[model samples]
Target: MILAIDTATKWTGLALYDGRTLLAETGWHSTNTHTVELAPSVDELLRRTGIQATDLAAVAVAIGPGSYTGLRIGLGFAKGLALANQTRLIGVPTLDIVAASQTYSEGQLVAIAEAGRSRVCAGLYQWRGKKGWQSQEPPIIDSWQNLLDSLDGPVIFAGEINPAAAKLIRAAGKSFQIANAMNSARRAGYLAEIGWQRLRRGWVDDPATLAPIYLRNPAETSA
Candidate 1:
């Protein structure tokens, strides 16, 4: 069984996957409450699912390109759990998890999420059956216009989309222009599935050194 955690944004998530099936899942907008709430949430989720911490054979965490503080809280707990339990550890890329949570679309498929400071983190993705999205490039942090200008084809943008981003895409006037949501927000259950697939391929990471995938320095922390 695998325990998965995702605190990549204000949306924090937790899930338990028993190899072939998802046993339990939960998520909420914690609004930066991760430090105080995550561990307790994990305990409650485990109790609801009738799972003991000792039952976890692996720990899967969404290492982020999103919220710095949230990522730290999540990964810190994941690493601690893995260390104490002696379970396998995996760090699924947060964007890949986001893309995996969505259905595929025609033309170029793009994944994006807010990157703070008015920047959007965008990445190119191709769906892999069972395994989910495989990113073609590292996510880039830029304005919506800059991201749109760099693209030259019909594209389906998934992940985070607000009215402002929708307006920016409409101004591009591409064939498949304007961002309207095609998928719900990302969930840790998808992260668990991807982590499981990676584990099958022998792709575990070292908990001692794993860090969040930060595409841009955090403005609040860096400043």
Candidate 2:
């Protein structure tokens, strides 16, 4: 069994997956409560699914270009769990989780997460047949206007998009398609699936050396 955890932003998600089956999954908009709520939520999922900590063969977590405290809380928890349980640890990028949640599309897909202070951490992506969406480049922190201005052709946008960003996309006209709320909301279920694939291929991270990806200095970040 593999456990997936995502607390990369205000949104937090968790899931229990075992290659062929997704036993349980849950996600919610957590208004700065990740530290307090994450552990209990994981416990509840395990209880409901009748899985013990030892049953987890691997632990997958979203290592982020996200909220400073949020990334630290999630990664710290995941690392501790992996160390104590002696399970493999996998670190999936936060934006990749967003991209993984999206279905295949013909052209470009932009995955984004709120970076606060009027900016977002976004990555450009392209669909790969069986592998799904793959990032074209490393994610960058930028304002919505600059991001939109950089896109020329028809593109699909996914991940956490606030009202103001939505407005800009709408005014930018028909070249863009904003993924619906359901598709855009990052889910740990997809994160688990991705991790399962990696685990099968013997891909895992060292709990001792793995670290969160921060696009901005933690001290300077507002989120």
Candidate 3:
């Protein structure tokens, strides 16, 4: 079984996946309460699924370009659980998790997560029939204008894009579609599926070396 957690923002999500199916999943949009609620939520999920920590083969978490406190809380919990259970821990980039939600798109895929101020953490991806979505540029923290200037063609935009950002995307003179915001929040089942794929390919990372991808320093302002 694979246990997945996402505390990348105000919303925290948890899920238990047994390779072939999702056993249980739950989430709450309580950013300020993660410190107190995360553990109980995890316990509730496991209880509902009748799975113990030691029964999990691995743990997956969203390592992010998100709220620093949220990332640390989620990662710390995941790492501790993995250590206690002697299971592998996997950290998936927040942007990649957002992109995975739109894996069925045939054209270019752009996953953008609100990065506070007027900037966003964005990644460009292209779907290949057999290879799946290939990232065009690694996730970067930048203004919506910068993202617009760099676009070459029609693209699908996914994640929590604001109205202003949406207008800019439309003005780029390219076909664009907004994916569901919930899809961007981090789906535990999807995280587990993706983690399983990476594990099979030997793409595991050392828990000690894993760190959240805060593309730009929190103190810096984007123009």
Best by lDDT: 2
Every candidate's CA RMSD: 2.3, 1.0, 2.6
1 Cα displacement, candidate 1 (Å) = 1.0
Off by over 4 Å in 3: 180-185, 218-223
Instruction: TM-score each candidate.
Output: 0.90, 0.97, 0.89
lDDT of 3 by residue, 184-206 (tens): 55566777888888877778778
Better of 2 and 3 by lDDT: 2
Question: Which ten contiguous residues of candidate 1 have the minimum total lDDT?
Answer: 175-184
Using TM-score, rank the candidates from best to worst: 2, 1, 3
The 10-residue segment of model 3 with minimum total lDDT is: 214-223
Which has the higher lDDT value, candidate number 1 or candidate number 3? 1
Instruction: Note the Cα lDDT for every prediction shown.
Output: 0.80, 0.92, 0.79
Cα miss at 217, model 1 (Å)?
2.4
Assess candidate 3 and give its TM-score to the true structure: 0.89
- Candidate 2 lDDT over 1-223, as tens digits, reads 9999999999999999999999999999998888889999999999999999999999999999899999999999999999999999999999999998788777899999989889999999988898788889989999999999999668999999998899999899858989999999999999999899999999999988999999988997765
